[model samples]
Target chain A: MRNDGETIELIERLARLVTNEGHAHGLKPAQWEALRYLARANRFSRTPGGLTAYLGLTKGTVSQTLMSLERAGLVEKTANPGDARSVQLGLTEKGRALLPLDGMATIQKAFEALPQPLRATLGDGVAALVTSALAARSGRAFGICHDCRHFAADARGPGQHYCRLLKQPLEDAEAEQICQEQEAA
Target chain B: MRNDGETIELIERLARLVTNEGHAHGLKPAQWEALRYLARANRFSRTPGGLTAYLGLTKGTVSQTLMSLERAGLVEKTANPGDARSVQLGLTEKGRALLPLDGMATIQKAFEALPQPLRATLGDGVAALVTSALAARSGRAFGICHDCRHFAADARGPGQHYCRLLKQPLEDAEAEQICQEQEAA
Candidate 1:
């Protein structure tokens, strides 16, 4: 059996590799993570609180990161319809443009080069590790809408989905995006 | 075939998981990474420049990180014997003790629960990904001493290893640790 220490080291190396890749696009590691999160998160999951939970960072840090992104014209805050007290986040055209240059292309190509079965296994293994780590800290999983416990298929209409927790219908695109309220079914 | 975007998302989640885990130990994500690096790096790989290369961060950020770590008493710096102008780093006893509580134990346990073959495959896959990412960024791999191109087994006394690049005999412990000068053979 591979020793636990060796296994941990490999996982740590993988994490560092991703962090190092973030430095290529004039963004800090945290900023890259936030940008990616905003791009993939559902509308309901795009608030400051949602980001703070998803990133597991202090409120101040998340706020500061958002301010930096906003100042760079990469992200904008819009009024939240569900709650006017808070705002929703969205990436600007410039931010969407920058996503292609965020250095994920190289990683994507590298991942695709792996044997197909191994790639699947690696993804499963990593997902399990993320779940385990988050569970250890009582952190939210921020899973995609389709996998959430509250997800209801075709509850509203054909090609539409529903969130039992949010009591709202979800567009097809939102069903595929991650949500802060996601819980494993 | 799994899409490239899905593969990249999995990799990003894995990285964020590690970053979130760092919050539990009262250390920022960068500080945890620095501590882990010092603990696993070989004697020659423990310099600030080595860390900068490994992390792909600015020299200023690395310097600040080292300063924070030194202030926390988790790391100590000593003059490098090979280079008088540079310094070497090592983990303090307290730092070594803190590692067990740095939230890796949960991950180690979770990893051990995986099937042994899967664990091996996962490690190999992650190592390959890390190698690819570092190569893309022109960053140092900081690989294990035994895997380095310059490593010569049993080149010194009986059962002794050597690093041709550093012209240094390697203790068994150092052979297993990562080195700054390491390049794939």
Candidate 2:
């Protein structure tokens, strides 16, 4: 409901990106999706809970991805001794083994193929943007620009502040919108 | 492995982008991940094969996403008339109903949030980029530049040509690499 067209497009582009990389890396898109979540996850089983919140999907979907990954030995699921209702998710040796950790040659080849300037331009900028976006999702309010933070007042003029990382300003309205990240930053 | 620290960083960043959006949309990351894939799908059903190729997700992983979406009534599965062995994936009315078609509002809001120059600099450029990216992926090519009709060898330079749409020069090596997209494109 809160998602606008631009947000949707951004989401789709991101998804395509993930799909492309995951497939190229020989991992399922879901596996990649799950893996990505796991990479950011604090606890293993909590991964599913995060997936449920971020995707607007059902518990069953999360369960299925976890199940398959577990079966393939890409991830391991263990009973949560602390929480009887939850299970922990973590990467298996095989899963980690299959993942070139750094990603396989194709990914490197892709990077190598790019011109140095292009690589520099896209590489750092994209990485920084991703990090900022990811961090924003954590529940804690990011304390960079007061007005720019989502909690800041937006009734004022232009209602936007420049982001050092993005090297651009976001609308005041956008700042007010909650970031979807799971943990508190 | 060929993945440079930068490339992994970029990919991880993209993942964060996904997580951020998922959190904002009140969708769990995994559910949102599935939704993102479904939106990019050609057909409503968006066969597991298509997902496999497009998202780089494994069969099992895609299957799980599909199964979950199906359970949620966001997507439905129908037998592939052409290939009895396969099933065509299609979005449910519910799914289609949730999607933001062009994302104009979000873009407009985002654009308005920026400085006049930044808006001007990125406005048309971003739109064109998205269009080119989408057009290039019309289920014909795998979103590769070379395979795109716009991709042409520069008559003046051995590896130089202009992407008719992006209006950028395309080098020969870059063009060749993009050819991989043609297989899926």
Could you list the chain B TM-scores for each candidate? 0.91, 0.51
CA deviation > 4 Å runs, candidate 2: A1-101, A104-109, A131-185, B1-11, B23-30, B100-141, B144-185
User: What is the lDDT for B25 in model 2?
Assistant: 38
Tell me the alpha-carbon RMSD of every candidate. 2.6, 13.9
Q: What is the DockQ for all candidates, taken in turn? A: 0.55, 0.12
Alpha-carbon lDDT, every model? 0.81, 0.51
Over the stretch B1-185, how does candidate 1's per-residue lDDT look in tens digits?
A: 33557667877877777766776568887888888888888888789998988877789999999999899999999988757989998899988988777765666776777777777777766766766666666778777789889999988876699999989899888899988888889
Which stretches of model 1 miss by more than 4 angstroms? Answer: A1-3, B1-3
Model 2 chain A scores worst on lDDT over the 10 consecutive residues at A139-148
First chain TM-score, candidate 2: 0.50
Candidate 1: residue A98 lDDT (0-100): 89
Q: Per-residue lDDT of A64-166 in model 1, one digit per residue for the tens?
A: 9999999999999999885789999999999998888886677877777777777777776676666666676788887778988899999978978899998
